[model samples]
Target: MEINRKIRSKKLSTRVDLTAMVSVSFLLIIFFMLVGELSKPKIMDLTLPNSCDISCGPIGCFKANRFYTILLDDNNKIITYFGLLELPIQSPKELQYGKNGIRKELFYINKKVREYSASIGKPNNGVIVIIKPSKKSNYANLVDILDEMKIANIDSYSIVDYYTPEETKLLAMK
Candidate 1:
């Protein structure tokens, strides 16, 4: 039996075809990339002025009715007034931080402006908001006001540091 045994020399190849796996991997990468772009958060576009003027020059040309001022105190209180700094209407009212507060007031003002523009046969002169943060106001309040501006769809707004004498008195009071 040993003399009749025969020897075999065949060997198996170790090569593997990875084309299908590679294609699947690439497809998964593309799918994830598309999902990432779709899941991105929406952001508001804010345009800042090129100059930092304490007071707007040539106040006569400035539309008094379209201007607004918002003051933020250290205690997280907001005071909003409309019209020129030389003479604000009555006094700034206290407002909370949300849709029912500043957002409502801004929409009302904007509506009046739109009505006035229609009467004059002119396009809307968007409301200009001047945000003044007192020395003691926190950063969170500033962010919140900015968010409110976005929610209100305000187009023209500025973060100004200068406070008029009247504003100073207002902030100094309890």
Candidate 2:
């Protein structure tokens, strides 16, 4: 009897295949892309409060401990303040026309709105965010900010008359 030797074909070699490494790399790439997307900044949708202080008295308005005004210029800049004596808090990051054409200054406005709301203890009665747009400003800017305020859950605001509070008080007395 002759002894027979068996040789496996070199092409049939079956060591640890790299197919799993390639699949893992793909899965990792997809996971990283999804995580990066989730980390990106999102446009906040603030909910505004509905106004019930329709029949407000002058003294009642002044009785409130805090006030806030937000002004948007045509150039998409923002100016904000809490009271008559308070200096406007301008955004340190200058807001210009966003490259995308939609005014990103809206995010700044929402941040300030929350700050004012917190300062005033959430204003269960009412908190108005005055939006005074420059004559040259498009109505779109006003609508957009108002929408943002609504999303921020801040309601009870009004499109105020151009009158200064002092002027309005005098008119009320008359």
Candidate 3:
């Protein structure tokens, strides 16, 4: 009589349970979506001037003495002048970018304009700045100038693309 032995095989399952993983992924996506929705984009508000008759002739809408023009050129060069280039109250001067540069000039001019307006009994009227960006200028230059305007607390300013004949001559000199 010989002893007999029996062998048994263990069974294995091939299916996987992905319920927890799927739930975690969905939660992460939802969290990111909610975070994105909660954050708002920063933007600047631009106010445009109303329509005026062509007869106003460039600086006609505003008094010439209170008008301040800033010309943005390539390489961050800024040429500024008070009143018309033809008859500038404060002849065209090349200024650099930043606090000691354009910002300083702006503060000085703003104060003077305010005093002049007050002397003339037009206390409400303030300095009007005209920003003329040349074709050679970049978008960053425009934005920087706009920031300067805001920093200087300027209430009235406009971005003009066209360059006058005198302005073209002035830029050519640079």
RMSD of model 1, in Å?
A: 4.6
Q: Where does the lowest 10-residue lDDT sum fall in candidate 3?
A: 46-55
The deviation in Å at residue 136 for candidate 2 is 2.2
Query: In model 1, how large is the Cα lDDT of residue 148?
Result: 86
Q: Which lDDT value does model 1 have at 21?
A: 100
Q: By lDDT, highest first, what's the ranking?
A: 3, 1, 2
Cα lDDT tens digits, model 2, 1-174, are 977989776786568879999999999999999999999997745433344433347544442323445555555554444444223343222233443322334444445655766777873444445555655567887777666665555554555537456433333332
Candidate 1 C-alpha lDDT tens digits along 37-141:
999997767865324322457654256676788999988889888886567653578888888888899888777777787788866456778899998899999
Candidate closest to the true structure, highest TM-score: 3
Runs in model 3 deviating more than 4 A are: 1-39, 48-62
How far in Å is the alpha carbon of 158 misplaced in model 2?
A: 1.1
List candidate 2 segments past 4 Å from native: 1-61, 85-123, 161-174
TM-scores, all models, native as reference: 0.72, 0.40, 0.74
Q: Which candidate is the best by lDDT?
A: 3
Tell me how far the alpha carbon of residue 98 in candidate 1 is from the true structure, in angstroms, after superposition.
2.0
List per-prediction Cα lDDT, in the order shown: 0.79, 0.52, 0.86
Model 3: per-residue Cα lDDT over 92-145, one tens digit each: 999999999999999999999889889989786667888999999999999999
